[model samples]
Target: MRVFGMGSKAWLLNCAILFACPIAAQAAQDNGHGKNASHAAAGAHVHQISNHTTLASGAKVSHALHTASGKRVATRSFGISCVPYARQVSGIQVAGNAWQWWDNASGQYARGDRPETGSVLNFRANGHMHLGHVAVVTKVINSREVIVDHANWQSGGGVSHGVAVVDVSEANNWSAVRVELGREGTFGSVYPTYGFIYNRPDTGVVLASVSRPAPQPSINPVPSDLRPLAERPWRTMEEVAESPSTPRHTIDLGINAGVSR
Candidate 1:
């Protein structure tokens, strides 16, 4: 993985496009492309967890870019898109065990990187966890709290949205975060159909997220329910990756912990 400093020219461009376009519209145009599939595949093959570096209460996390051929890809810190998952680009399988962390092909999330406001949010599945496409981070409340809107986080296929405020006082454990259920749905109906968030690298460790139960799927689908509030035209990856406000950074994290070969 190639590490870099946060806040680069690319980051600025990313921010501009990310905020300018509507989330729903973007997803609609680029729903479930080869990129997401590649990341999902890479996530399926990674092994081991808990080896990445950490921060001291909101320390900036670093990021890197790796090519599909096990080559280091050039990236500007948080500016790189976690949207579609890393494996999607590398054609690698994301490694994970029953109820474990979804390790990207290059172990993307755990790497110390700067977090963005709307990047893809990740969670650990304690054990025997087998659900896919779970939730989205609707809002970020300071460095300690976040709001999650999910559809099928639970088994019943219920959809619900709630807020989770991270607990900084207690080892940054999400046990203190607040979770509230609002509605119900089946699978990714009310949740993410295919979206990414601008996430800060330290979000998972520093701000413990509160995990809540997803709502039960309704017998009948809600009409006009899943339509995203905003819609926009689709753009090429180059276009998408070249907007302002992308948050650039110099690659600097030390890659001591290697992914299982």
Candidate 2:
């Protein structure tokens, strides 16, 4: 949970690396292209669904593609961003798009404004936050405040654990909140949010249970005829020859048995 500003030195180093590595720049550009394509597909799907459904609150619903397990399919790496970070810690496989998490979670996960442990608080895109942000609730202090763990809140990319977030909205609905800056216990800027995404198991598409091979019985019953062989004591060459129940073969005399000539 170390928080530090992206100093000029680090910035210059990053610039130099980007300038020197053409492959890295190309890869970043390709990733952006893929993200754009995914967003376009999600937008088209949302548009198609919106034409048939009518909203009671008149609020525009966000939409994104989801996996069969009800988790969002991420096209890129889950680095120092609130979306994938929350998803990783919360055990919720949500998509890469942070702004559309609430709408994408509709009927799949429980949504509310109240803070709960393991729930993801989804923020809305605003002037300060263009892509929106998400954080996993770690502890609920009271009805007014809670602690969360998120990433990339500071200049240098890293997780901010146990950061206090308070409901500062006029309605006290948790629609707006001010998160603590680092471990300073001081509230930062106010940011608007959609709501909290609860980790509910009962809803959404039920995944088929994987049938495992039944464990083999530990006590293997040996046949009575083989019991003597299983329990027989070790026999020397002379012992084997003397035993009436055993057969003997001529031993090779060339092999030495620790006896000096």
* RMSD after Cα superposition, model 1: 29.1
Q: Give lDDT tens digits, candidate 1, residues 149-187.
A: 444444444333332323222323222122222221111
Candidate 2 has which clashing residue pairs, if any? 71-93, 72-93, 72-94, 72-95
Which lDDT value does model 1 have at 212?
Answer: 38
Q: What is the C-alpha RMSD of each candidate to the true structure, in Å?
A: 29.1, 27.0
Clashes per candidate, residues 3 or more apart or on different chains: 73, 4
Off by over 4 Å in 2: 1-79, 201-261
Output the number of the TM-score-best candidate: 2
lDDT of 2 by residue, 141-199 (tens): 55556667787766555566555666655455676666654222234555678878889
